[model samples]
Target: MENGTMPSYFYFTLFKDFVHMRYLILILTLTVYLAILLFNVIILFVVFKERSLHEPMYIRISCLSVNDLYGSAGFFPRLMVDLLFDTNTISRTACFVQIFTIYTFAVWEYTILTLMAYDRYVAICNPLKYHKIMNSKVTALYMALASLYAVFSMGLAIFFSARLPLCGTDIARLHCSNWSVVRLSCGNSTLNNNIIGFFVSATTVFLPAFFILYTYVRILIICQKISKEFRGKALQTCIPHIISFVNYSIASFCDIALSRYDSDKFKFVALFFSVGFLVIPPFLNPLIYGLNLPEIRKNIACLFQRSKVGHFPK
Candidate 1:
């Protein structure tokens, strides 16, 4: 708790309530985690195995599945361990790693979604040029750039956070976060934590959001002028992306609100917001895309049929 000294570990004060329902909570989260893994793996296998799904849009969807797996890995494993063993302490190194993984996952989610929006725009707006513009090399470059940007932005934020001299060892939430650690700093962290943090958040979250909005508006305008059947097809393709974006935005807002406001008076609501950010997106992305997209649904059906046929008694 000293200004010049740092704590070796952070104790999550929120886990005190888990003592009574630890087993039940563990079972539920484990089930959800297993489902997340299964759903996303199915999507990835379908996309990769089916050469027809090698297009940019499906590639972006696959990236989302991979990111969901990555983000879930950062949260569920540690959470289950804490619940199972009745431990709330996390080593400083492990805490920061979790923050990086979770934060980067958030950044990648938006970036990948933004890329998907762009792919949809080009497809709907300039159908003839879609393949030319979003070729394999271009898609790879977009992903690489997004990944590097997420790393640099989140890395800078984490680096600044890791250097702060801590005044406390207790985090109020179930997990460690950059803002939570910033709040524990003994000195003013406004410049690095808030100012630069705001810039990072804007680029990773807000800017991409605005860009997606812009693309959708343009697509809408284009759709209006096109034939009704074409318009319906275009909108149908965009429906899943729009749903995913809105769902993620709400979840992200809950997390931000939970971090910025004092929610001690509403512990249940606070807990919902805290865990929902990690849980909802990974749990839903695969289902949203899988069920909505005809190709994915067809491919998945074929996969299961093949499995059934292979196992049939000859």
Candidate 2:
């Protein structure tokens, strides 16, 4: 251990263990990664280009898609390289960057979900005041606050994890996470490292999740008193949000699982769980929202039709 820095490189035993399935995993990873990119990018493009889709709810959904893309890009490129090649190791600085990007993305995933839930609540429960509550200023403020909150919360854990002198070089997981890095720190003398890491993540992740669930419950109760048609509309919107939350929860659960049960027996299982959160929601979100929301589906169909009509002879 050195005073100024930790290990120069971290070799992932998780990737190393996938000797037989490396190529298979690489193919699958590439497919899912591409899907994530294609889907989220379309959402962003459509949202920005179509003036009709520029409402607060659509804007919030766009931000979530961007967050998902950012998260997928942070991990999948590095991970795909490892899967296709033998370079299971990553530079310490690069590892830290991944840690920050991924954790911040995860934190904001929850934050954005919380805000989306609030947006839905207002749309359903206080329809007349929706615009008043979710004005341009308010929408921007929600996003800014979510980013800042994620940074302060996850940044604390990363700070604790990064400042410590790592005693080992091998991380048992596919990517560099704060917990994996913190565990390499030698002494249990301080309360700052792992303890704070867990506390920071638990609070940051769970509190937002609890809040999202609470908001949905209220939304559900309120929907019951409304007309059946309106209730169906609410379900159509909220179902995707719930599914995305579950997607994220599964990814977070994978982290805990790997830390507890990293072994040869779980290598294949680990590979599936490791990439699920990053790939699944991004890959599915656009499809979920696009297909479920009538306005988006209609806009997309019109977009394609316009493209088709433009290509024909005048």
Candidate 3:
């Protein structure tokens, strides 16, 4: 490593010890990757094909499925290749691209989830004006803004990270992260990186979290005044979103913890936390939304029935 020069490649030191189980892990990884594609694509196809399921909430779910696909693609293919070949090295360009893609997916996910919360809020708290407030154009605009913000924020973070000069190329985990790369810097850039990261996290993560809380609180207050029947309906709509949000939050916390305090003594736990965010959300989101929302569930059923009928030559 030279001063003020980035490493040509990064090595995942953790992968060295996992060579004996590479084949088994490769099979499992392939299975999960394919499942992620299948489930998220099913949601995407159902949302787009069924016009009846084209509400803002369903639209956001479709976006989430797309984001899941994007995020999974960033890691799974490269990971499968690494597993199959027992290689732990990733080129610098590919590494940072993965970082940017993963970060954007995460930030965009919360953005869409926040939008969904606001949609639920309007639908429940301001029923009569829901359509006017959340029309397709408005939804599009909100998504556009969110996408821009996700890209800009993560891009800036990557920009800052890329400026630092690396002194080492060994990453302790399976994947590349901004923090991991920043930690490799020979200079005293950690403090400055922390400050930038904090501000970025504040706007991209915490602000959306607080806004979601506010929307739910308002929804709760409105539900209390309304009849029990109405309350049940409102909560029914919210439960899936709530579950998805909490699931993501927990996974995110695990990643944060792993990054901050990872150690060889707790390698297994560290491994789980490292991949939890990528795995859990992609796996569970479709299940949560499909099973919980009758409209989506019904449409998905209809889609399968149609495929079955078409396949049987009826």
Q: Each model's TM-score?
A: 0.96, 0.91, 0.96
Ranking by lDDT: 1, 3, 2
For residues 1-314, what per-residue lDDT tens digits would candidate 1 score against the true structure?
A: 33545789999877786578889989999999999999999999999999999888998999999999999999999999999999999999999999999999999999999999999999999999998999989989988998999999999999989988888888878877899988888866546688878999999999999999999999999998999999999998999999999999999998997888776677668777887879999999999999999999999988888888785212
Report the Cα RMSD per candidate. Answer: 2.0, 2.7, 1.9
For TM-score, candidate 1 versus 3, the one ahead is 1
In angstroms, give how far residue 228 of model 3 lies from its true place: 1.1
Instruction: Give the least accurate 10-residue stretch of model 3, judged by summed lDDT.
Output: 305-314
Off by over 4 Å in 3: 1-4, 311-314
Give lDDT tens digits, candidate 2, residues 154-218: 77777667777766887777888777777677766336665776677677787788888888889
Residue pairs that clash (backbone atoms under 3 angstroms), model 1: none
Per-residue error (Å), model 2, residue 94: 0.5
Tell me which of candidates 1 and 3 scores higher on lDDT: 1
Candidate 2, after superposition: displacement of residue 137 in Å?
0.8
